[model samples]
Target: MGTVGITGDDGEFHLISMWVAPEARGTGVADLLLHAVLEHAGVGGGRIRLEVTEGNIAAERLYLRHGFRRTGVCGTVGGDRPEFEMVLDL
Candidate 1:
């Protein structure tokens, strides 16, 4: 659970944060949460964005499977922490 919003200057809703309990991992909770936000008011069929850690393959794959394509590099580049932006137009 987390705050969901459209922080983009263009008003595109961004998926800020999402977390699933350890016991819920691999049980499809992440999928349901993602889909819920994507399907939220004024979000469905519209542009939405998110970022995932560079090495978090599971999350990257999950977003990709939901039709989100890589947009570009997110946050600080060449730093110890890096994330990639992904977007979906439902």
Candidate 2:
């Protein structure tokens, strides 16, 4: 199974802490998780935001496929892992 979380602030939702167990990956779990989040976001102004680590092509592609675009914002996790923000405006 997989899990994803979302929080609302201002007029947008922020996606955080998404994960799929290694053994359950590649089985559409990610898509399901994202779908659930998107469905929940429908009641919250239809905007969702998330951050992905730099070089995480799979995650980035997933977000992109779901209509998320980069916001040009950059930051780091753990003081070294580069990350950037993406937003989906439903």
Candidate 3:
């Protein structure tokens, strides 16, 4: 499951949360879901952004494979380990 947060004042679409159920992972569910989100974002214009928890190499690779580039905006999330902001321009 996933959610696309509304465009902020700056018009950026934040892909808030995206995940596949454990039993559904690697069955192409995530790919279809992410495809829909990115397609919508691309059609709408502007940029799409998301944050991935630190040490999540699999998730990071998934985002990178979708064309999101890692920015220098790294910081602790929820007062815990780091998170990185990634973006894809539509």
**Candidate-wise lDDT, in order:** 0.74, 0.90, 0.78
User: Candidate 1 has which clashing residue pairs, if any?
Assistant: 45-90
lDDT of 1 by residue, 1-90 (tens): 332344443446778778888777898888888777766724435688888888899989888888889987578455768878998876
Clashes in predicted model 2:
0
- Candidate scoring better on lDDT of 1 and 2: 2
Q: Candidates' TM-scores?
A: 0.78, 0.93, 0.84
User: Hey, what RMSD does candidate 2 come out at?
Assistant: 1.2
Could you tell me how far off, in angstroms, the CA of residue 3 lies in candidate 2 after the best superposition?
A: 0.9
Regions of model 2 farther than 4 Å from truth: none
Q: Which whole-number lDDT from 0 to 100 does residue 87 have in model 2?
A: 96
Which residue runs does candidate 1 get wrong by more than 4 Å? 1-11, 41-44, 77-79
Error of 1 at 14 (Å): 0.5
Q: How many Å off is the CA of 84 in candidate 3?
A: 0.5
Q: What is the lDDT of residue 16 in candidate 2?
A: 84
Candidate 3 local Cα displacement, residue 58, angstroms:
1.1
Ranking by lDDT: 2, 3, 1
